[model samples]
Target: MKIAIVGTRGIPNHYGGFEQFADFLSQGLVQKGHDITVYSSKNHPYKESDYNGVKILHKYDPEDKIGTAGQFIYDLLCMADARKRGFDIIYLLGYTSSSVWQRILIKKSIVVTNMDGLEWMRSKYSKQVQRFLKYAEKLATKYSDHLVADSIGIQSYLKKTYNAESFYIPYGSHVFSEPNKEDLIAYGVTAYNYDILIARFEPENNIEMILEAFSKSSTSRKLLLIGNFKHTDFGIRMARLYGEDTRICFLGPIYNQVALNNLRYFSNLYYHGHSVGGTNPSLLEAMGSSSLICYHNNDFNRTIVGNDGFPFDNYNGLKEIIEGKRKEDFFHFLTENIEKIKNIYSWQRIVDRYEDYFLSIIPKS
Candidate 1:
């Protein structure tokens, strides 16, 4: 089947979770012999003529900024071109006003959108942007032929908010091989010497709270925070505040897969402070690496890790966990849960689920 994936910054996944999801699924689907096309931002320099058996179409819009508005414009252009390309299905990763327009323009196309976390609920957006997103989300749910939610929590939200039923397909992760001793020396750290947190340094991620709590803790483990320094004003401020600390190392975004995997694999523990978003990629990656998990939201983290890891709602809770004030059977639980995660969240399994869903939607000839 010919398929077109829309509503992402594009492939190779140097950015966020949705982009990574798009990259992995598109490649996986291509391997399954489906004709796939990924609409990418023209501004992204990695636009190759072709990528791993999938076609890449670069949409150029210079007026676009890196926000919701920019994405809407890019999606408009992509939808117009995709309609002309006559794809059997248009798989959208997120919602936008342009998606509403796409539904109007392409009546026969099968629309499938993955409503990735509650974006408008995040504190990072301005009030006006949030209002726009809420409306767009309504249009997306009302119009799309199929919807996918990345986590059970997100699926529940969709049903509660829009009374819409969606397929639940969690993200995937792969365990990292141990890095070479020489490579570990380059980072000036021995294996398992530090705790790691990888996320966009936004307020919703609760980065400040994590930093404050970790800094006050008595744990001897060093803390390494990796994320894009320029993603937000909060990121810049936090980098300046935490970068100077001896125990805390603020390494700007490390995009190399080998380096990131090694860092995660070798970490003593993984800290995830995102109070929003469904099934975060970093958390899954850390789990795949068999790192001990301590995260922010009780409901969100527990949904993924069960009782295998620690959950904290505030700075005090985080500190207590770090200082060993709250000790449970986390390690044993973690070991057992790893098997569950390995079985459920493999990329091949996730892509197969997607393929099954897509085929179920296609009309009989």
Candidate 2:
């Protein structure tokens, strides 16, 4: 089957979760002998027309110059291009900017949209923008031939809010068996002597709250935050407030997956404070990396981790966990999370699920 994957910055995963999903899913589908074409931003570092047997089509993306509004234009270009591609399936990774142009999508193609986290719930956006995002979400549900929920929480929310049925397909990750202590040397940390938090510096992510918890705690372990914290106002404030702490280090965005995996694998504790988003890729990656995790207590997180990891609702909760007892067996959480990655969230299993779902949904000729 010929497929075109839309909605994401590009392949090779320079940006975030959806790009990573596209990078792995497209390549996996290609290995299965499906004709896969992925739409990329014109500015994506990979300049080639092909990547690991998958076709790459770069479209205009002016997000660098004009800011977030450029995303709408880029999505318009991609959808307009996909309309003429004669693809059997047009898999949209997210419905943020492209849903407004849903009418322009090919009538013959099976449009499967991955309904990302509830955008309206994000604290960064203003009330007006949140209302607009709500409207956009409605349009995506209305026009798409099928919907995919990346977590059970999202699936339930969709059914309750829109009365819509969706396929529950979570994100995927590979188990990291490598623990290169040498990688930790470059970052000035030792094995199990550091804690890490990798996420975008957004208000909803609870970065500030987590930082406060660490500040109030007496743990000697260094706290490494991996994200582009220098670019945003909130992040700058966070840096100004927390930068004075000798234990907290803001290493900025580290795109090297191997380095990240090693960091997570060797860390004493991985803090996942993301309050929104369904089945977050980072959370899954942390689990797969053999790290004991402490997640923000919410349905989106709880549905994925179950009782496998520690849950913290606020700064006080996390503070206690940081300074409190080691009552739970450490190895048990690590092994259970690894088992989850292998059995349920592995890349191969996710690819197979997507392939079968695509085949099942395509109208018979």
Q: Please provide TM-scores, in order, for all candidate models, with all chains considered together.
A: 0.93, 0.98
Model 2 lDDT, residue 213, Cα: 95
Residue 94, candidate 2: Cα error in Å is 1.1
Clashing pairs in 2: none
C-alpha RMSD values across all candidates: 2.3, 1.2
Give lDDT tens digits, candidate 2, residues 1-365.
99999999999888899999999999999999999999999999999999999999999999999998999999999989998989998998888888999888848678999999998888888899899899999999999999999999999999999999999999999999978889998899988888999999999999999999999899998999999999889999999999999999999999889999999998888889998889999999999999889989999999888788889998888998877624235888889889999999999999999999999998888
Model 1, runs deviating above 4 Å: 63-68, 179-181, 325-331
Evaluate model 1: give its TM-score: 0.93
Quantify all predictions' global Cα lDDT against the true fold: 0.80, 0.92
